[model samples]
Target: MDGQLPIDTRPWPVRRDAALHDQTMQQTIGVVTKRLANAKVTAYAAYPEANHWRQRAVEVKRQSIRQLEEHLATFTQQVESHGGKVHRATTAADAIQTILEVAQHHQVRSVIKTKSMVTEELELNRALENAGIAVRETDLGEYIIQLAHEKPSHILAPALHKNREQIHALFDQDALVYHTEPPASEDIVALTQYARRRLREEFLAADMGVTGGNFLVAETGTVVLITNEGNADMVTTLPRLLVSVVGVEKIVADWSGLIDVIQQPALSGVGQRLSSYTTLVSGTRGPDQWEGPDEWHVVLLDNGRTQLKDTPFEDVLSCIRCGACLNVCPVFRQVGGHAYGSVYPGPIGIVETPLLTNFEVLPELPSALCTLCHACGEACPMNIDLPGHIVQLRQMKQERHMNAIGVTRSYRWWARFWATPHGYRRSMRWARWGQWWFVRHGRIQSAPGLAGGWFKTRDMPPVASMTFHEWWDRTRGKRQ
Candidate 1:
């Protein structure tokens, strides 16, 4: 939405700790994620055989990722079979160059885009601007972030961190929508209408329409774009050329998989049975057809995805980006997406970022984040097993950091020591003695060293003089 990456670029702990204390972010993220969590609950309860549908999605996704190349080839051949051109991009630069070339061929001046996270990954908007072409974000949340010069904080709800008053302020600052009435002062109806009226001009004048594919059905060579606001339809309706930049992983063999693709994401994301618009593009509009683009193009992006198929992270390729994981993630609920410092955020982002992008610099990303809650897996409509994938990444990271032989030995020593009954009791007794200095009124009011910061906002109960096992044995003996 910001037309730029909002990565903090600091150490992970520094960024996370900063976001933790940010009262505004805490309030905003907490309320929004919790509401989405509740909505997901209500939505799932209403659906029949929801778990069955989820399992079906997982099966479909696994099948697709395993034969990703075949499906992608079928998708491309079918698109070309239908008179649409397809470009295969191995990197972000390739995608941008492909899009630019398409723009050149079409003599594109202005472009109106729907919410496309892959496009954001390519920084397509900024690249277009650099090429002296104008780009407008048609999605409402995306538009706000574009105006604010900030990246999307959430995958589905880009402006999740901002409230209505904040949104009104953002609109107020935009010179494009200003008039005598000042745009209805926090009225959702007025704000939407104001945006709709203005965006219509952008849509009408756009030479090209760009979108991200939710699912590409290979059998018929169709690109599916879903949106709740009908903005994608508006963008596609009148442009001279339509281009979809899609990840190779988004392709499915046929229509049988498309229904679950549509329904599961909607149920997990906005809790809707279906999104308001599910636009399917096969080819350029014919004279017999009502109205559509004159040209159609599909850009299939690799961007390190090929490497994932054989790796332990292959399951990650199956993600549908429904963002249900984000809604239920305790870590995401607190810090939000910006703290993760990636285009992809939440549980999925941490797992994928290293695999897709620079693992050298972002080596600690997964271990730095994730509480290993498994809530993400429960929420994932595709059942991607996010925690399992995270553990793999952690193992990979630990191997690299295993150069610290002393730290490894000490950690292993402690882990083994604590595993024995005698060591456990001795350690517990010593820990109780050690904490006696910090205990007050049945709680450890403070802790020493690095632990002190943790207790700054938290309290732990003091350890009892006797172990639970000892107490249980004595109580049982008395009962007997």
Candidate 2:
């Protein structure tokens, strides 16, 4: 439970209690995502050759995952050959224990970490801190959220929910402990500079550094960390021992395959032509090289991913963690990451949670949070049909009798009506009449039964006077 404290603190009860507080989160994510989406539009227009590259990237990822086990073994061997240690963790507990053991053996008192969603999913910081090690997050967004005792609301932008004023307040709070006062005026650049100076000391003093792998190339035995901020580079190179945690699906066959999967989505997701820093560390620094950590370790985590390897959901392995899907998802835009109640949020989490956990206990998970808009599918670099996967999960829930009664009844009623035209027409007429109570000025302010929630935030279109079949009959009956 202590290991899960960070996650439990932000559970459904906590999130619901904090929902109104998340209006700020909603606004912040909306502005950032919309801006990024628009930037993507302009960026794609400039790189007209992106579509060609996207298709190639998809093929490369598909080929890599198809031979994941073999490539992983090859990657392990190459890493070992280069004087790096490899640990295979079949479960989350094993991964955490392995990292903690490494930290303890090194007598690590303080650790610096780069932004890694894999570590977040595993709750690594809490695990390390519980083992009596002080862990500091080096990424600017991650550091802010860490101090605030909050989870990252977005994958890429951990503290996207925080405004400048909130940041200034946080810095001021920390300044009291340091017996120094922050600047009176609130500015992002100043705040960032202060954080950098503080983190620079932590970077030098920390016994170990930890990072999450964006991709693991089998041929070169390299763990790649892509970032716009260069925090990953510092974390990877500065400490005495460097520990990298990588999901099993992150393994690629070779550098060529790694390059393809990372390039397109890295740009599209963040609106960057390329990440400013792409660090590839195969092992520890040689005696000749003064920079880089003295010891390197890679922990490859299965963590339920193996169960999904060959299934219909296998395409999920193609995700590069660019987070474009989160930026484009309408439901994610509304509730933000905390409402989903998982470390991985948005479209990816909808598909991932069911596969990774006890779905029977969480039957409403995939359906309750999705709009079935297929926007995530369009944004996906590997062309993973995310909406189709969500539907598949819903079907699984139905077959297992895990679906909610309301959902089951609704589907049944729609199936029956669509099968019979006369029944459908009569239903539509009844619906129109029933909606009269809520209708005013040709818009429905409220609706009866389950649909009322839908009208709460959106305008419901007025029903048409006649069905399409009836209009077709009236116009072309003689010709028929």
Candidate 2 per-residue C-alpha lDDT over 353-392 given as tens digits, one digit per residue, 9 for 90 to 100: 7777647233455877888999998888778888999999
Clashing residue pairs in candidate 2 (N, C-alpha, C atoms within 3 angstroms): none
lDDT for every model? 0.82, 0.83
Candidate 1 least-lDDT 10 residues? 1-10
Q: Write the per-residue lDDT of candidate 1 for residues 435-479, one digit (tens) a residue.
A: 989987889989865568778988888877777977887888578
Off by more than 4 A, model 1 = 1-6, 176-181, 402-410, 432-453, 461-463, 468-480
